[model samples]
Target chain A: MTDLAARQAELVRALLADGPVPAGFDPDRVRAEAAALLAKRRGVAARLRPDLAATLGDRFRPLFDTWARENPRRAGESFRADLDAFARWLQERERQERERRSGHRLD
Target chain B: MGLPTLGVGIGWRSEIDLTVERLPGVDFVEVLAENVSPDPLPESLRVLRGRGVPVVAHAVSLSLGGAEPVDPRRVAHLAAVAEAVDAPLVSEHVAFTGAGGLDSGHLLPLPRTREALDVLVRNVRAAQQDLPVPLALENIAALLEWPDGELSEGRFLAELVERTDCWLLVDVANLHANATNLGTEPGRFLDELPLERLAYVHVAGGVRHGDLYHDTHAHAVPPEVLEVLGELCSRVSPPGVLLERDDAYPPDAELAAELAAIRAVVSR
Candidate 1:
């Protein structure tokens, strides 16, 4: 793999290290799309708020793109709900990160 | 009869209650029903009324174009608030905010199709029937476009108003944003639209992304939108026009300055 590809894979690996890649998630595809998205503009991905970038990297792009393609016009609410879930998931991940560093879970 | 020519009115807020109460030259206050309590009207509205300020209710959460059933409870709430304030009209967005059971955190556009038109007409009719005064639907700033748009936004709006006999609340900022984003001419869009039906106009600021524009409402109104609104005022000369400042609020002086710019244009 190219150096950029290798670094991109490593980032994805670090993000997904908590568990097996969740069902229906393709880390390779996410990395590929992220790379392509980055290639179109060097700092484009970085411009996204960190939390949103990480969530899109890990969960949203895969879920919504798939759901939106399959359902087309019918996917209006479903598409939005999936993105909201992705944002909420990112919030949880940030909370977990804070907890791990603090030596106590929030719950 | 239509609403009278109320000079410059700012988007109503509770934080500025004292300012609104104490001010002498203010024309009308657009009360946000979403910000008020669920119960009938409150003392704040009473204060505006007592101060001899005409109050109009503007709704933010109606999701008028959503696929879900219109929330009768919320409509009832709006009706009660309108009655309480003795508002002349109640306005909501043409776009849907909540979809697929999730609040999108934004106003999304409906595709310009016959089906979408039918849906908008039905929703507007429902709101008009439930509310106390004439129902007004405002144009929205859309981030995306449908693949099969069959009509221009202005024409779509004209058709909706005609079908439902409803009034239009033209948000010039949104019109400008769509023009820049969609590669259309803002003046052309305004020329084609039925300007006479406009009951109110909204002007706000936005952010731009490479060839696209986003209506962030975080700054002073851009000159392009102000120009279109000026044209609207002369052509239609609507009763009330309100400036929508949802983010990065400038000081009252700055806002008043912007309002003055609009007044100078419309008055000319």
Candidate 2:
């Protein structure tokens, strides 16, 4: 890849993916920026689906953060679709947690 | 070619659709290109357009500065929206939104190296060719500055304009945020910029978080940002000035007051 293409790719990976900050750039600022981007997603998600925020309540951020790590928004994915996917993810997690508890009770 | 006079305007959001209609002295309004469909323009937008108010299409996901070539579909959508709304011009950010397999879902900053500028210029020209109306590029608020920059933001924009002859949508809130967060001299940026090519100006509110100013666009336009707008107005009377409030839907009274404040600055 050309130097420009490589740098742009690395920068995007560093920001959205869990990739290392490219050389010469400020690591702290890059990391801070990544966090800020996630924070922005959280804000939009909460506003988009207040029911999710209310249902999850205190667990919303932690759960959303987990879902976000596993699912970095795909290129060109609309915010609304991403949030709906998060709702599905949360429901699946809740089902698994219930199944695990029920299996323990059977023991 | 000269630009149309847009006068004072506000960003049109679905949440505050009624509020925008109620507000007075609104010469025009901008609609997010991604949010509207040209085939059937939203009722709110139709009402505004029916009143003979101009609507400008502002797109967020163009990824204009990405290494990848500009997406033809995205450019096509922006063009269709502009035609539907009868916009004088359409605008997108100078920053790239996402790249590779992941989407940041927010406007991301670009490195100021010559190599990056070359890629950006190529991508911008490609999209500009497809756009139906004149394309205006806006300066985004960057929280992180990449290392080993070759050109200042102003010089980079000036050169890009020189190469393509696109218009500029200067966002003063972003200027304030960059100055506070990355020490970018807003004054020097304006001086270096070719203000004659300005299409319009964006004025939004932001909150200072810890050490950085977050261009949230959810709060009232701060005095520091207004000062930056005043500075730009002093240099050149921009054809338009817009107040953008994205998330927190304020009351009609407050929205009118903010619009009035922006008018006061440019009216001078």
Candidate 3:
């Protein structure tokens, strides 16, 4: 294959290898779920700062790749669970940021 | 197929919305169909059309060079806009924008070979079938040269015209920028093209990146490109020559001055 074709194939392979985690895989699911949650949180953080969004996609993509690989057997369930946890975490984090901005203190 | 040669126009950007509506100077405006589409046509474009302004449709996102089938959806969208504005001419770049599910984020040059030409011809034929008027393809600038084993740029373009029977929207600025950046001879490139096939000419300004000059289309037309355009006009005698200002857009006042300069050069 030509260099361009080779590069394209490599990208497709990488995406495919990072498969969905299977059902009832609790430990792997928890880890992948946690990672995806963190990623969403980071995305929210990046949005408030444009430069971070620009630079972070590359850095953060590896995290997803790893999570996908770790939960490869139960990739779908784990990935979704992690994503749900991440979204929950992001909401809480955003609330805290808003509270902090408003000078509200937690005991 | 034979569009009247309306001499020296400018590509109207929506950013200059208020300016374009108020000004009556530019001989004509090349309206970007990509910007105002699927959404209602803006009030400004309607006013321009009503006032008998000759608008030419210029499009983006055709992805003509990509592996995917020509998106009939965009063609329908463009065809509607052309009829609405009564655009005498429509044009797009002869470069691919995205490939392999990754957005390249810019126009990417195709290798000038039979394979690439075949791809281009197929796509153009598909587009022209849907479009009311002939579709002209613009030459794009690139940093990398094809790894030989390909047709010359001129030959590829000339053959494309012959094969597809499409018109040429020659961007003199892109040709000049590519020649300077790629070390290709501009004069020879100009000479080899089928000038009679050109429907219009686009001239713009650019910046130098390292040793290579980039087609930024930011500034006023450079003297050399202008000189080349002057020569091109005499040789081809096309009806419309447009000045494209995509970045660092000068104020309408400054744009008027540039348009006046173009009018002088092309009319001469």
Candidate 4:
């Protein structure tokens, strides 16, 4: 990658993927920005996927935020695709919870 | 200099479609380019356009400043929307949204270096070629700055305008946030910009989150943000001013009153 592209990737990674604060940036401010960016993404996605957001109800934001912190958005992925991924993540999590409740562990 | 005068307007969201329609003296409306499709226009937008109100397509996913080249499909989508709505111009942002393979999901600030400027210029010109109308780039508010920026925000914007012949969509609320959080001088920042190339202005609401002033379009337009709008008005009569309220929309009367406040500033 070129220097400009590489540096932007580092910054993007730092914001969305819990990467390091980079060489010379202020850690506190960047952290705050990252938190804000995550929230904005969640908010915009929620607006786009009103059905999923309504289905998830109040848990939508917290659940999505948690999943987002881990999943992070892939560049060039459409918002529709990202929301679908969120829905799938929610389904998997629910299945795991149900299995645990039934005392049946499955792959 | 051929930009049309878009008296005063508000952002059109699905949630506030009716409110925007009823808002008195709404000269025009800007819709999110990503949310709209040219094939089948939304009924609400159709009604607004019927009333002779212009709709400007404001896109967020262009990533014009990304080191990676601008996406052709995204540019085409924005152009189609502009042609469908007959927008006098379209506006994106001066900042890049994401780069590489990870999307930050936020309009991140660019390091104001000449090398970065070269990348932005190339991407902007390429996108401009595909666009049917003039393209105006908005200045975004950033919570943090990249280390070792070679140029100030104003100088960077000036150079972009000079090189690409693109217009600007200056966000007054963002200027206020930068002034409070980054100690950016509003006067100097305005002076350094080429206002003649300004296509329009965005006035939104922001609130203070400790030391940082968050440009939350969900809140009421604070007096300080209005002060910045007033400052810009004093310098030059902007071609148009649009109010942006993305979330927690107030009542119809309240939104109208906010528009009135903006009208009051520009008419000063």
TM-score of B chain for each model? 0.92, 0.98, 0.94, 0.98
Q: How well is each residue in B1-268 modelled by candidate 4, as lDDT tens digits?
A: 5899998999999889988888898999999998888879888999998989999999988898889878799999999999988898999998888876888876888999999999999999899899999999998998998898999999999999999999999999999998987889999999999998989999999789899999989999999988999999999999899999989888899889999999999998
For candidate 3, write residues A1-107 as lDDT tens digits: 44444332332222233323323233342343334333433443343344533544675456434433443222123223544554454467569889887885553
Q: Candidate 4, fnat value?
A: 0.88
Better of 3 and 4 by lDDT: 4
Where in model 1 is the C-alpha error above 4 Å?
Answer: A1-107, B22-24, B38-42
How well docked is model 3, in DockQ terms? Answer: 0.05
Worst 10 residues of 2 chain B by lDDT: B96-105
Q: Model 2 misses residue B138 by how many Å?
A: 0.7
Q: Tell me the TM-score of each prediction against the true structure.
A: 0.71, 0.97, 0.73, 0.96
* Per-prediction interface RMSD in Å: 16.5, 1.3, 15.1, 0.9
Native-vs-model 4 lDDT? 0.91
Best by lDDT: 4
| RMSD per model, one decimal | 11.2, 1.3, 10.8, 2.0
Candidate 4 lDDT for residue B104: 81
Give Cα-based local distance difference scores for all models: 0.65, 0.90, 0.67, 0.91
Which 10-residue window of candidate 1 chain B scores lowest in summed lDDT?
B97-106
Q: Candidate 2's error at B15, in angstroms?
A: 0.5
Name the candidate that leads on TM-score: 2
Clashes of each: 2, 0, 11, 0
